[model samples]
Target: MKVHFIAIGGSVMHQLAIALKRKGYIVTGSDDEIFEPARSNLAAEGLLPVADGWFPEKIHKELNSIILGMHAKADNPELLKAKELGLPIYSFPEYIYQESKDKTRVVVGGSHGKTTTTSMIMNVLKSAGKDFDYLVGARLEGFPQSVNITSAPLIVCEGDEYPASTLEKRPKFHFLFPHIAIITGIAWDHINVFPTFDIYLEQFRIFIDKIEPGGVLIYNHTDLVLKQLVEQHPSSVRKIPYGIPQHRIENGITVVTLEGHSGALKVFGEHNLLNLQAAWLACKELGVGPAAFLKGIMAFGGAAKRLELLARNERLNIYRDFAHAPSKVKATMEAVRRQFPDRKLIAVLELHTYSSLNEQFLSEYHGAMDLADKAVVFYSRHALELKRLPPLSPEKVAAGFGKKDLLVLNEKEDLLKWLMEQSYENVNLLLMSSGNYDGLDVAGFANKVS
Candidate 1:
């Protein structure tokens, strides 16, 4: 099959292009601008566009398919030309569904924990000698590509609620009709697309309904909101409720003892434990038994940035996480504090996303950082301007977080200065954000923890 890509510079899009190329398909692509890693990766595969601009001539009737990336707009010249030629065009998720429709689909979804949980399931399945295709949001250990397509009978996906593309306004998860689905937990996020909490929640409801009939819906029973939602939604899919696995923290390690299969896990946190239970249930449905699953999962370190330890010492350790939403921030911080109750937590959060910077949605962060002994919130004015959002004041941010003593700084230099003055004796530094605190020097401060 010969395929062409429209706006192929996206993180996952470029990766998908590479996968198709390695699959022996004739692949070609173009983008308005290609960034560093994507550019390098695409060039390595000889799939990078000859130019950075769209070339309408690339669209032809001979092409079997045109995979569209979210970066491409509806009126893109290449897209229009493809329509003119009556060629097949598909959004990333739509194309993924087309490829895996015959396979047994297992999708993990939630506002948080989805990536880690999906990674766990993939690791267990792989170690169990099962052949499967996968699409995860983050780079995982032992997995070279986040997107892999093959003739594997089973496919595991980290379902995302974001819009599939400009052409397909529905959530990306809606396209993957899973035979077995898992929703870790639902929390309001992506305020720009979903204006209210209820609206944001409706997406997951649609996702649950999209599961194939006679499929299984595994949900987090501990999340009261999700529990009620799953119970209220009547469907033919079998309902399986799961909670945190039986686990304990010993010497900063989380040990799980389930059905006599006992071992210490490389990843920690109540959230991760809950994720582990979800992964266990999904793997069971996929034919992996408890003993086998435990043996495989015990070696799972974590996804790229989900509570990754950046720097460590005897008395202090610094952890970086891709957690920006209120629920994620709270859970991540609470996990660190619980793991090292004797140590002081110097937590820093960056208000980087459009939702986090918006005054209307800022109140959702109330008490999110309260678990920390020293809490700090940072945001960039340039980011706000780029998003065309209203200017947010420091007082407003403090009130929104419900912590008057919260050290809110917009300037990266100020944040760096304050962090440098902190006492790191017996402390755990937890830095949380989808962005890197406007490029603050986290390593510089982490190096001083010793």
Candidate 2:
């Protein structure tokens, strides 16, 4: 197969390119800008473009398909050329569906926990000697690629509700046609795209409708919204609901308790316990029994940046997490507070994404950081400039969060100064952001406090 990808420097796009290359397809791709990690990863796979930027001539009659990335515009030069040539074109999700049509597709969807849940299933399956293909959003410990489209009969995916591409305006999850689906929970998000809470939630409704007939839909019954949605769709699908598994935290380690058996786990927190339960149900559907799933997940540490430990000592620990949305903030803060109840919790988060920086969306964070003993919000003026949004004042941010004691910082140097001055005795520092503290070395910065 001959395939060309537009805006191929994207995190998922580059991985898809490498996966296709591994599948013995003749793959070529282009991007206007290629950033690190994606650039280096593509180069390592020998899939990076010979040169950056689109080449109109690359879209020729011999090209079998063109896969579009969300980064590309509708009138992108290569996209226009491909359309002019009358060749078959697909968005990322459309192409993924094309490859997995014959397989039993299991999609994990929700506002959060999808990546962790998908990783859990992958780990259990891998350890149980099950052959399956997968496309998880985060880079997992055992998986070589974030996406793998192979000949395996079962395929597990972390289904995101974001748009597929400029050409395909539908949510990516709509195209997956899942034979089994899981919705972790629903919280208002993506203000830039969906605009309203109802509109943002309606996407998941559409996703449930798109599942194949007789497919199973597993969900967190603890979430009222998810429970209501599943109840409304009673006959169309079989519903499986799970909550936090029986577990205990002993001396800072979490252990799962099952019937007549108990096993220690590397990952913890209420959110992860819920994630593990959801994953366990999905794995059971795939024929992995409870015993094997527990054994495998016991070895599963965590996916990247979800409460990732950066530096730790006997009394103090520093961790980084990819938590930007309001839901993510609540879960992440709660996790840290619950894990170390006796320690003084200092939480730092960055408002880097368009949604988080918006004044209208700021109120969603009300009480989200209440669990922290000290809460700090950091954002860069340059990031606001690059995103073409208005500069957010510290007063406005503090007021928006409704946290009178919240400290907000805009300058990186000042934040670093504050960090250096802090004492690390009997405290846990949780640095949470989708973007790194504007390129500050978190480990190096954490070490200074230790």
Q: Which stretches of candidate 2 lie over 4 Å from their true place?
A: none
Clashing pairs in 2: none
lDDT of 1 by residue, 1-450 (tens): 999999899999998899888888999999999998899988888988888899999888999999999999999999999999989999999999988989999999999999999999999998999999999999898999999998899999999999999898889999999999999998999989998889989999999999999899999999999999999998879999999888888888889987878989888889999999999999999889999999899989999989998898887888989999999998998889888889999999999999999999888999998989989999999989989998999999999999758998999999888988988889998888888777777777677655
Error of 1 at 275 (Å): 0.4
True lDDT of residue 18, candidate 2: 94
Residue 241 alpha-carbon offset, candidate 1, angstroms: 0.3
- The 10-residue segment of model 2 with minimum total lDDT is 229-238
Q: Write the per-residue lDDT of candidate 2 for residues 38-118, one digit (tens) a residue.
A: 999999988888898889998999999999998999789999999999999999989999999899999999999999999
TM-score of each: 0.98, 0.98
State each model's CA lDDT, in order.
Answer: 0.91, 0.89
Alpha carbon lDDT of residue 320, candidate 1? 89
Which candidate number maximizes TM-score? 1
Error of 2 at 60 (Å): 1.0
